[model samples]
Target: MKKIILFPILLIISFYSIQNHATAVTKSREAYEKTGNVIWEIKTKEKLVAITFDDGPHPVFTPQILEILAKYNAKATFFVAGNKAERFPEVLRRVVKEGHEVGNHTYSHLITSKITAVKLKEELNRTDNIIQMITGTKPTLYRPVAGIYNDVIINTAIKNGKFVILWSWDQDPRDWRNPPANQITRYVTKGINPGDIIVLHDWHGSEFSQACQTVMALDDILSYLSSKGYKPVTVSEMLYRSKTNYPEPFYPFR
Candidate 1:
């Protein structure tokens, strides 16, 4: 009789363990899709474009952007520089801690559009590895340096199970060149509509601190977008909502 009871208990335990593992698998898949490029191929069917900040994790500018994001309770995606990731690991952590997603922008910020295939993979691998080290998960999303890429780069990202994310050219403002903040705000707010993705900077240069009119314009832009009945969402949340996902182990599902 004792043996019979023990056997049943053991069976129950095994069942629970299997159930838990299945749940884990589901969650992992969800993460994969959220970072996958399915959304890249599909435009924001609604008035929601992803806000992605690239080439960052800089000391001063990164923090400023994070602070504003915190203030507005806004979430955006940060496509980090790999070498900078190693240099300023804390900034990367702060980004995660503050409820934002981190994606790979490559180690050297070399434009994948220009590099050879071998070099592209090497750069992506190194950057993805370092980002995983800091964030505890490898990103399946790849935003080429300076939003630059070709068919080869896009194909490479797809082949590696990564989605190549691009931007909608609504607001650039040339902040990298120290464009005026008011003008930047005017353009971004005026141009923004439903399902629009506004690109901005986080950490970059001394001029970037002055150049990034985005941070300053956040209040006006957010307010305007809100008035227009659009909600600001991070890249991951946008993808997740749209049912975009990657495969397990952060690679192509098929």
Candidate 2:
């Protein structure tokens, strides 16, 4: 009996190990166009990292970040809050127009738990309708407010037809509090490896232009990482690179 139990236990462990190691393959290539950011967030094994921006397509500063990203020809994921989208519809358009991936950040920026299933779908649908109207493409990625996700929120999002996206790591500089550039860079450049999905803000709009640290500091971070042979692809790229069905390599960070 012991032998029987031991064999079964080991078999279960082995199956889990393999499932944990399985590569992520999207059966729907059509899913790729809309779900690229979320797909990459969950899949991929490459040395790619998705540098994601949340909170805005801010009225003023988002354009600055866009200019910088454009200069590098880099791709990123932006989770735009729905109300912000409604206010700055042009910015939302500019995000997609500029080749950045956009995902739902919620309609009112409410936490996932506070919302009922009905309200949750409404938030997602509202954002979906708005984005589809503007870009003619419906988004498949949704990040709950502040990443405060639960089973209900996840299920609701999926039912509303979105992939639940949360970060695997955290590198936030609390740039919202306006930490120094070097401090911010340190948080990012340190503890960083391949397959990291870094969350940065284009604008918290908190009088926190402290991201100015990155203005001078980005080159340093990029140059050093480049020397280390790191390729900073979008978060979607990292998900695709992991090919790991599990979120082992995630670093959902600021």
TM agreement with the true structure for every prediction: 0.75, 0.71
Where model 2 places Cα greater than 4 Å from the true spot, the runs are 1-45, 206-220, 241-254
Global local distance difference test of model 1: 0.69
Q: What's model 1's lDDT at 114?
A: 51
lDDT of 1 by residue, 1-254 (tens): 99998999999999977754442112232343364452333345666656778788887778888887776677778888898889889999898888777888888876434565667788889988998898887887778777665555665777776766666666565555546677867877777665566777776464235545666766676677667777677665666556544333221111
TM-score of 1: 0.75
Residue-wise lDDT of candidate 2 within 167-226, one digit each (tens)? 655555555555676787788878775666666665564434444544455556665566
Q: Which prediction has the highest TM-score against the true structure?
A: 1
Best candidate according to lDDT: 1
Model 1 ranges with Cα > 4 A deviation:
1-47, 206-212, 244-254
Q: Residue 110: error of model 2 in Å?
A: 1.4
